[model samples]
Target chain A: MFAATMAAVLVTMILALGRAVLGPTTYDRILGVNMAGTKTVLLIAVLGFLTGRPDFLDLALIYVFLNFIGTLAVLKFIEHGDLARNAGDGE
Target chain B: MLEMTDLVDLALLLFLAVLAITIAKQRNLFVVVIVMGFYSLVSAALFTVLDAVDVAFTEAAVGAGISTVIMLATLLMVGTEEKTPSQPRILPLLAVVVTGAFLVFGTLDMPHYGDPQAPIHQHVAPRYIEVSGDEIGVPNIVTSVLASYRGYDTLGETVVIFTAGVAVLMLMGQALRFRQRDGDA
Candidate 1:
């Protein structure tokens, strides 16, 4: 059962990777990478249970945090062109 | 019958190789860096499948997280178009192929994965697994070994990361501000 689910997730991850590689727009690539990160979190969670170590969920939780932070950071850098600028400085 | 873990591991490695090739082929630095983050995610999943949870965690945090941010910040200073190298790629490609071949050759004498008789397992691993829990009072032996048995190594790693962060700030701290041309998505 776990194997089947993992196979599905891995398949989807490949699709997401394809989306990233074939991207004609920057947002498409960001979305693809973001989707891949989400699938990886799922893969890690299932992997924890499959390996008989449910504590692997702890790592999944961290991946979730890191993935979100990374995506948002990329978007912010892309939009603002600077990570340190204040929000009100539009000029 | 091969285990499902092995299949999953193989697929993940394949994805990693594909990502590497695509990232190399991309001229857009933004796309390249984002795909690099995606590559890290696949490798981290592979580490998890191999039962290296700690390694996966660090890879996700450092490889996917901190490294992506640092590289993107670098792009902010340097711009997103990868510069075309003036030199021919033939010699460097030859060097990489040779080094890769040497690496493959070097692996010939290593024990296969999960071999119980491997020298790594024969070393202090046995004692750490058996006695460290009792001695260090940490239920997770991996934690005990990393925090207690190998305390100095962890401390050194901490110092190295700290130094790297400070040095990066010293060098690129001011130039990272928004350039007028960076606003187009």
Candidate 2:
């Protein structure tokens, strides 16, 4: 059962990679990467159960937190063109 | 007998290969960064399957998380579109193929996955596994190895991360100062 679920996650990840590669717009690539990040968290959690090491869930949680920060940083940088720019500054 | 786990591993490896090829072919810096994030994610997954949970955790945090953010920050400094290479691709391609072939040849000597008698499994790993429970009393052998046995290395890693964070802050501060000077003028 875990194997099947892992296989499904792998499929989604592949599709996401494909989208990221073929992106006509930066947003499409960002979205694809974000989706892949979410899938990775799921994959890590499932892998924990598969391997009977429940402690691996901690890694998944870390991934989730990092993924959120990374996505936000990318989007913010794209919008502002400078990471050091003030958040409230109007373009 | 190849188990279900092995089969899943094979599938993941195939996906990683495909992702690598796509990333190599991509020209957009933004898309490359995103694809690299996916590559890190898949690598973390692969590490987990290899039963290296601690390595997997570090890979996800550093590779997928911190590195992705750093790359994006870099992208902000350098424009998104990748410049076409001025030099011919043939020399680089040959170099890459030769390096790849050498790596494959190196792998030929590696022990099969999960082989108990492998050199790595024979030496320090056995002692760590045997003594960690009684000596360190940590349930997670990885924690024991990284924290107690290899404390200096872990401390060094922490110091490196701290230095990087400080460097980034200093650079950002400089940029902000320049902006303020412009505003004052």
Candidate 3:
């Protein structure tokens, strides 16, 4: 059952990669990457069950936090064109 | 002899291959960064399947997380679309293909996945697994090995991360100063 779920996740990852590659807009690529990150968290958690190592879930949690920060940073950089922009500056 | 786990691993490998090809072909810097994140995610999953949970953790954190943010920050400094290369692509392509072929050849000599008798499994790994419970008393062997056995290496890694954070802050500080100067003018 875990294997089947892993296979499904792999399929989604491929689809996301395809979107990232075929992107006509930057937003499409970013969204695809975000989707892939979400699937990856699931994949890690499922693999933990498959391998009978529940400890691996720690990795999944780390990925979750990191992915959120990364996506937000990307969007901020894209919107502002500078990461060092003053926080008081209105968006 | 192939198990369900093996099938999943193979499918993930296939996905990684597709992601690599797409990343190579994409010219847009933004798209490339996004595809690279996918590549890192798949690679981390592959690491997990290989039973290297610690490796997977670091890869997911560094590869999918920090690298993506850093790349985006770089892209903000440098525009999104890649500038057209003045030089021909043939030489670089040949160099990459040759280097890749050599890498593949190198991997051919590597022990099969999860081989019990592999040199790595034979050496410190067994000792760590055996002694970690009694010595370090950590349930997670990875944590024991990283924190106790390999303390220096982990410390070095932490120092590097700290230095990077400091460098980024310094750059931002300079930028802020420049902006203030402009405003004053």
Candidate 4:
């Protein structure tokens, strides 16, 4: 059942990639990337079960943190073209 | 149970192939990166099927998570679209296809999936599993391996993260310098 679900997720990822490539805007690509990230988190959990290794989950947790921070940084850089932009601007 | 696992593994293999092909054909860099993340996710699933949870976690985090953000950051610095007008070079892609096919063929001699008697179950894994419960006391074998047997590798991973953080800081500093120079002009 998990494998089947994972296959479905793979199909969804392919569609997301297509949308990203065809997307007319930056936001669309970002959205696609975000979807991929969400799917990956689920993938990690399932993998831990399949492999009989729960330790992988810890790494997955850290990965989640990294993903969130990385995505925010990317978005900020996109808007301001630099991470150093004054935070006070609220733009 | 046997039939079910086999069916699922086959399906995953097919999906992985399709995703890889789609990713390669996609013209937009952002789309390519997104598809690559999907590929990583699928590969992680495969790793799970193969009973390598530690690798799967790393794949999920680094391959899918960090890579996507890095790709997007790079896209912002450059342009999102592929360099205009040039069709994708087919020869290199063909080479990739051939290499991948060879790899699959090379696996023909390997044990069938989920064979309990396979070398994987016989070798180092058993000791790790046995001692893990008494020595390390971590029910999660994957964690034991990462923190105990492979602590050095984990330290290396931490260093990589530190390097990435420093790189980001440097990038921000350069951007500040550029802005200041423009203002003075």
Candidate 2 TM-score to native = 0.82
Residue pairs clashing, model 2:
none
Best by lDDT: 1
Candidate 2 chain A, run of 10 with poorest lDDT: A78-87
TM-score of chain A of each: 0.91, 0.90, 0.89, 0.78
DockQ of each: 0.83, 0.69, 0.70, 0.30
| DockQ, model 3, C-alpha based | 0.70
Tens digits of per-residue lDDT, candidate 2, B1-185, equal 97767876887787788778877777777777777888888888889888887788888888888888888888877888888745557989899999999999999999987898999998899899888999999998889999999999999999999999999999999999999999999
Output the number of the TM-score-best candidate.
Answer: 1
**Candidate 4 lDDT, tens digit per residue, B12-85?**
68767777776667777756766676577667767766667668778877787678767776887888787775
Give DockQ: model 4.
0.30
List candidate 2 segments past 4 Å from native.
Answer: B86-88, B137-139, B152-185
How many clashes does each candidate structure show, in the order listed? 0, 0, 0, 1
Q: Which residue ranges in model 1 land beyond 4 Å of their true spot?
A: B85-88, B156-185
Q: What is chain B's TM-score across the candidates, in the order shown?
A: 0.82, 0.81, 0.82, 0.70
Candidates' RMSD to native? 4.7, 3.1, 3.1, 5.3
**lDDT sort, best first:** 1, 3, 2, 4
Candidate 1, B1-185: lDDT as tens digits: 88877888888989999999998788888888999999999999888887787788889999999999999989988999978745548989999999999999999999998899999999999999889878999998888988998999999999999999999897665555444346643
Cα TM-score of candidate 4:
0.63
State TM-scores per candidate.
Answer: 0.87, 0.82, 0.82, 0.63
TM-score, cand. 1: 0.87
